[model samples]
Target: MAGPGGRMMAGGGPGQRSIDFKGSSKRLIARFRPERATICALLACVVLSVGLSVIGPKILGRATDLVFAGIVGRDMPEGATKEQVLESMRERGDGEVADMLRGTDFTPGEGIDFTAVGDVLLFALGVFLVAGLLMAVATRLVNRAVNHTMFRMREDVQTKLSRLPLSYFDKRQRGEVLSRATNDIDNIGQTLQQSMGQLINSLLTIIGVLAMMFYVSWILALVALVTVPLSFVVATRVGKRSQPHFVQQWRSTGTLNAHIEEMYTGHTLVKVFGRQEESAKRFAEENEALYEAGFKAQFNSGVMQPLMFFVSNLNYVLVAVVGGLRVASGSLSIGDVQAFIQYSRQFSMPLTQVASMANLVQSGVASAERVFELLDAEEQEADASPAERPDEPRGRVALERVSFRYDPEKPLIEDLSLAVEPGHTVAIVGPTGAGKTTLVNLLMRFYEVSGGRITLDGVDIARMSRDELRSGIGMVLQDTWLFGGTIAENIAYGAAREVTREEIEEAARAAHADRFIRTLPDGYDTVIDDDGSGVSAGEKQLITIARAFLSDPVILVLDEATSSVDTRTEVLIQKAMAQLAHGRTSFVIAHRLSTIRDADTILVMENGSIVEQGAHTELLAADGAYARLYKAQFAQAVAEVD
Candidate 1:
């Protein structure tokens, strides 16, 4: 697996079957120590197999020439030297040589003992057997290490996704990122495991065979070399053409997966809106695009193998014609001609394997580039300084002309100033998109202010470590998230001190959640699904409130905490809030006027500035922006009563 900064972790799955390592050469090298034992074993196997195999072919050619020379009475014609003769005989079929020297020369039925041939054949067979065993073991070992690395890569990518600044997800698509981590990595794995294994073995065989051919007939080897480069050129051209198509294929796949995920998540919405047909049509468009891209990529890459074989076959014909002539003219032995045929196939096989793996290499490279891009992402900055420890519970927070925006050019909070004294409940009232949430966000250190500073007890929030600053305050948002766990676990989330069952129950009762808890089959022990999706929104909200109460922080922030419930629940929540906010400084954000009526100060905000600020009655007396809002809510309350 590739780590942050493009370094591969020690363990990864086997090399990709398709593209091999592609862009991760450094990662592969970093983990080379684990692979070293396997590589050494594989190299040993290849050396033994190739050396023995090459020698045997040459040995058989010499044996044939020697027997023919004896028949023609011309001292073997000296076509090959004594060393070449021995090698040619060693290269032939192990069983044939064994049969020829089955009995001693002293035995009556023995066929003119070729015992040296038997000895060489036995050695070659032993080498072949050992090589085969070692190669298999090496392949398995490499695969295990590679698989581990791939698993780490997936894990690292997931951790990055979670820790990345929230802003990163705003611009990137979920499905595209998922594709990079999952499907792309799997493709790389498959290519490494199967094709890469074959490629290595085939490559070694080809090189060994080529060397032997050079010794046999340099001219014929040159002719074969010409065809080798041509095959590579063709494979390269085809791969270059196929690469864009493969990338498009994966891109389309991501789009299709995104739509599918969306549809599944919003099935109820789709059904209610009667948009199934339209959804299917969109899906079809994406699916068709994927098919076209896939066909183009696979089709082009698929043709490369056969093209290489075709080129190899042409070279084979030329070699056979040229070699046969040399043999007939008494310049080459019949055994030499036979050996050339075997070497031709050997040289061609590696090229064919490479051609077949070319597309895999390209695809892996494409996927690797995407993976590296994500791993290279800039992490959200965290304060490196040690957390500051305040002497006393000042609980005072002040925004000194604090201004901020999600985008730098577009200001959300413009020269906004607010102050909350220790033990004061400050209610922030604003129309939609009036930087109400933005103010709280700054206090939470979720986003940095474009200008000005927010201070906790006179210390800039930014100067204090984010965790420490958040630790001093508790927030209950409009949407509550509860992990899949028991109710007790949920309530204890942000608590600084250890919470007992009694404390948890006390918090729940204060939030009016204890009433519903007794009705549950398992009560506080009931397991919640992901995000508390199984629970009602009102109940989830009350649970979140209980959580805040349990935390018992010096500073509190309630952002529409009771807005999603019934009137009765709202009343109960108000009582709980009154209790929870008794001593601690609080910041309440709400659209409901009644919730904040008892607040020490109410700030009516419009645009990015406060339009009105005073006590409820004082604002009503002013007959300004607060007065207009109060009148509207009062009228609605009267109409509901009627």
Candidate 2:
């Protein structure tokens, strides 16, 4: 079964697929190993900030005590000692007031002490100010750490792509792969940035607030924790339900992206075929699937916050009731109860905050899973050390009993052998899927042969690094590829070393592309997109041929190199290829029987084997597969002319 972001596994949707929460979380954290130093600094700042914040409420509690004491103390006789005033209240049947008064340290003759209170308030303010400053620093560190981690991840992804075999891409959509590299990685970064620092702060605040609560009054502390189990239940239940949806959401995102990319790239074909409505219907279906998955994921996770808030409010009532009782019973001061109330809030808030962020954390982890899957995919076999070089570049290429298959049960090419001597041009003529392209692929090492081996200059090609082997060969296929650059730069891309402007122009002239290039507004300097937007199909074909010419390869392989060009241009390209083929080995795969009559060898391939091979004249005289194909093309041409 193909996994997420490749193709959906058959018979399994999001609900049927469960994620390893602990495993994904651990792996995601492991990606941050390079940023550990920055993380340590961030943690230190958070710890200090939370420590000071937890202390702030306690300091304010002291000021609260002073004011309460002043009010009570002012009602007592001015001349009396503090003990006598409390005794007087007890005797007068104001026993509850006396009990509450016992917990405060107040002078009977005094009122509010503004100066002392101001000092306490100022110290609390300073602590909070420092805490905020430290948190700000921590946030900056968070950004730094996350950005660095993301940068490395992108680099890793790019490197992995280069190392992967072509088959990996063949089995997957370009947009899906791109979504994992771009959207998924970006999501992971945003998730970490949004949650990491805040999670740390919330947790530290919880711990610090718990300690302060215990210090203030154990009874009230126990009261504030009464609903903690309930909060945990709500969080886990909602989180569990939402987790699958998050996975599905990302999966759907990749699928939708793949559909959109496929459609956009083939939009011209769709319009030509009048399939616009059908395409829209398919797009709508994918979009709705994404919306459904996203909506369910969000709605399920969204339930956590309100449920957590309910638990917190319940805890609040318990603390308030128990705290008031403690104050009335003289077991705790009013100011202590007030501070305990703030501590209860501090304790509940992190739990609530974490619960609310369930969706973000879940979403990020889902993206992390996707990215890790890409990274973990089996890469192509490592390139070997270069084989011992031949005495010189002779380009004598041979394949002995090469076998290959895209699927194990279906053999596409089996036990194939071919040899081309140095300085010879070999033309391969075959119907579609007859392994003409597959043969060249094996030669280029795009796909390794399943059995036996291929050799260049008497050295096993597999023993050499892929780059080392392919660097000596030049390829121009019917489907040309050009990057977004000027015509000069695009052509120059073929050369392994820097080339002079004269050399570039000469190569273009050789390919018959120089005339058209010179007519453009900027000549060879005119820029084009990767799709070669400014050039016609045949013009693009000519530029690619020019590119191949610039490479000046030791071995040239052309697969329908002139398929896009007009008859006049095809003749010109053929002349250029013939000149380039001098003193080097050349392999041409073509369907046009007329173009390759002068080749030193003509190979007729069918069903992955060479059915007939010789000079074109000899094959025609033999009246075999090559002659039959040639006669068929001749008849088609005569019919068209008539």
Candidate 3:
């Protein structure tokens, strides 16, 4: 089930789950191999600590037996001491009693040897103190190792994301990617930090306690071992049942987060469309699913601890009864019985802990599998050996028999050819989904052409490195994006080299954004929120235009750049665009027929094919597709005027 951070609860249950415990564990262990020295030291400390723990109870039992013997000796026949009682036993020819009391150091009148008991207690205290110190050191070492490994893991994930192609992101939800990067990584980190050391120590404790239990009495050890298989069976059954639910839980959580992000970002549209109730209903459905999954996972996994506790208590009862019988029969001494009982509990304690941690361990493996999936995703193909870089690039560009399809079965553009010389404007006009922006994406190398070549002045763009090709091009998209930074920073974002404050202002002025900037409370220094919430859409577009201007690119791509502005502002932006495109090649993708009427060339695209291409007036004179589109827009404009 989903947790507070929208993470799935531990132990994802069955059905085509991707969790490979053995494989993931091996990889996880390989990641820690570099810290083997520290791990070894930590293990050494665990051994020492558990060794001390195992011996302490046995030593304490000796003290208990001494006290009992002293009490019995002093209370015998009206305050006779241990030495006197032994002498009386010898005088009465009780050889067995004399031998039993041989090592009991007791004074004639005292009930117990306070000095010897104090010494044994002090020694046990010292052992525990050292064990505590070792454990503290081990804990610190574990933290350091775990944090270091996770730090490197996060770095790898970040680097891997940068190397992945845009297609990878196109196929997945943003929230799903984010969940893997943040929540899943954090899960791995927490599990390693919390469970890794405990697992090691518990295992060692179980082994040591078993050995000590057998050393005390094999029959009692067998009684304790009886409950172990039962505990394992229960834990395994519960864990197997809970695993799939955990997977579903995380999958639903990712979906829910994606939905929330979409709704929040588009809340304006939701309210405008009167979809609040519908949105709330969708959220409730997701929330209820998360709750149900979470409850089942938690309930199934949660029962493990109590079930293990019952087995432990059952083992405890068996040990007590069996050991009491041995003690009464003189097969086991009172001291041995006490020590055996403590050992039995100690042995079962780790079993209980491991049983309870079964779910967490499984959850960690699931998280690891998800993380590995991202890491193992197909990255962008590397550039060819000895990749070429454009030198002294000209603004000339050509699309030679270009063909593309988002899906191979449904071809979009086929055998398309185009060429633009330096210092010319090419206006591409089309309806929505007519592959207008797709052409721009191909030009920018955001997506490679399916079967064709796009070339710069002479060299094919496919041969040049993506960074080199993109470095000479500038783009302004329909959806303006401004990061959370000062207004000047957004404007200066286009420049690869450092830009001076004066240059930033000049670009803004050219884009007709300077007047609005000066009116703001902080002007160019004003901090923009992530969504640029306080800024008008037109203003945001202007800022992006200014950024493109500052970049001084040899080729410019403006796709719906002026779509958000008012008519007056559009006129200003068009003037700015004219100046920006004066000495550079530009591709202008626009929907408005009036806007591209002055273009040097206009290409009318329909269904991903160029139906008409010519100067605006020429196309209108031919009375082709462009002519019909212009007539429709012209009629709409006149209707508005009337």
Candidate 4:
């Protein structure tokens, strides 16, 4: 939908929060309820596992206390007791001592029962097992949800790209858009699936583990938790430093991708000019920048785990010394001391995870920001009301005082007016920057006009649904684009109804593409890769023309459709153009005078204004801009032939 300043909002969809992260996480988290459920389950596992794990240490400590109590019963002196005998006896009575491990009033089977303790141990083991499995399930669920959302995001971005104002692409590099569509999306997918998944689990696990730690011993819990804030501060520092680095890395890669794409597209020109060294030098610089950025970012992130561990170890040492003193003073039980250490680790582990996730979280945030930016781009204006769609549209187009500009400061099409009656052919000819293509752009609503208006059968085009307006008109671009698909599929690109073989052949024949199709081994079924393959440039252009032909639009736009084709192909395309122009309104942008010689009206634009307009003979009689351009262009053509 439209937003402030009449900009189209493409950033967020259903359940998506705004790109800004300030207070946005709360909304994003709420929208991600399924992922939140997985987080909760992970927390359950963490709490359960931590609780069960502490029991082992408690059991060992209880056994120690029981042995100490027995020695006191035997009236053995601490200094006079034989160390070897104590050790040997303790080993032999290990199972029994643990069974009778009681804090007080341990005369017989009053406080501690070894049999019931065995049951407790088994229960703890079972809890740990179940928790592990639940944790695994939570992980799988989180990944599934994240991946599904990311896939949808990629798809949505692509769709928006397709519908965006054509001017949006004018100032952008193809490589940069390509990188965002492919590489940026891929990075985001990995972060959400692998890294963000763990981050969510870790957050919940930390909360649960800390709760258990406090429940066991608040004093020890406090001691264990001291590392939390410390680690967090350190992580924040490192994360801040690394976040920008990663963003830069992403940008640098986009630049590199752009360079690569440009090189590949112009490989023949580069070779002809013998500029391999210059290209290699540029690539080397890009590669070196990428390597440095990657190394620094990873190295900084790597230091987090070790730094956190060092803090954890310090906390561990303090807990052991302080807890041991409390136990010796009889203020704490041996089991309590043992459980404290386990809880301490549980408390610190999540902190470690939080530290580690800083890298991924930052990367994800950066990517999300970029994706949201694209989605936030302005969309063309909506129609005032839905126009009545026709099964077969009438061929009438009028440009009344139509003016446009890529930028407001410079007008491309001045306040010029033109009209095409039903079944009429209009040709536009101009110098390189004379707004020839800009006329087609406005008619297609690829960009809104700066002034005046254009209409189809007296109904203002701006008041018509973009889809209905475009569907009524067919376009053949100068540069033909074919996706990786079968020739038949490409030919039937935008037709709503399924195209029959006969219809496909008919369109192909009209475009003079049928000859090439039959020459291919697979004919219409020939599978083509995105790379130039199994077809010539002229053949591809013909196929695109055939696609437009199959749509059966009442108005046709040919933007230098035959400019890139060979002489023979041009003749064939010219014949096809004549047939396609019959019984329809057609707009042709041609640099070649020969192609537009027979057009009913020829409008020559210069500096965004129509300086010459009339029939061929009429323009020549006026001896204005059109006549000069014709003579200059035609003279070069004759010289080239000679």
Best by the lDDT measure: 2
Report the C-alpha lDDT of model 1 over 1-642, residue by residue, as the tens digit. Answer: 434555332221212233333456455445445556666765676566566666666766555544443443332234544344434545774444323322112222223335655664566567567667766765775577567657777887898876677667777777777777788778767766765566667777887888999998897788778787788789778976777776666667777777887787678789999999999978876776676667778898998988988998998998898876666554566667777877887788778888888787767666665676788897777674765656686699898998877887877788888888998999998789988887888888777788999888888777788778888788999988788899888998868878899999999999999989878989999999765756798999999999999988889999999977899889978887988898889999999998899999999988878888989999999999998988998999999999
| Error at 567, model 4, angstroms | 3.3
Error (Å) of candidate 4 at residue 623 is: 1.9
Which candidate should be chosen as best, given TM-score against the real structure?
2
Candidate 1 local Cα displacement, residue 483, angstroms: 3.1
The C-alpha stretches of model 3 lying farther than 4 A from their native spots are 1-18, 75-111
In the range 1-642, model 3's lDDT, one tens digit per residue, is 655676433323335454667888899878988798989999999999999999988989888887876786575775665667777888999866666555545555556888988998999899989988988888988998899889998999999998898889999988778888888889889988888888989999999989988888999999999998998898889887887666666666666777787788889999999999999978877766667666776778888899999999999999999987776655777788899889988888898888788777767777787888999999877765677765777789899999999888999898899999888999999788888999999998778899989988877888888888888998999999999999999999999999999999999999999999999999999999878977999999999999999999999999999999999999989988999999899999998978777788898888888989999989989998998988998899999999
lDDT of 1: 0.76
Q: What's the TM-score of each model vs. the native?
A: 0.81, 0.97, 0.92, 0.86
Q: What's the distance in Å from true for residue 9, model 3? A: 16
lDDT of each: 0.76, 0.90, 0.85, 0.75
On TM-score, the stronger of 1 and 2 is 2
Give the number of colliding residue pairs in candidate 3.
Answer: 9
CA lDDT of 43 in candidate 3? 94
**How close to the true structure is residue 292 of candidate 2, measured as C-alpha lDDT?**
72
Query: Candidates 1 and 4: which is better by lDDT?
Result: 1
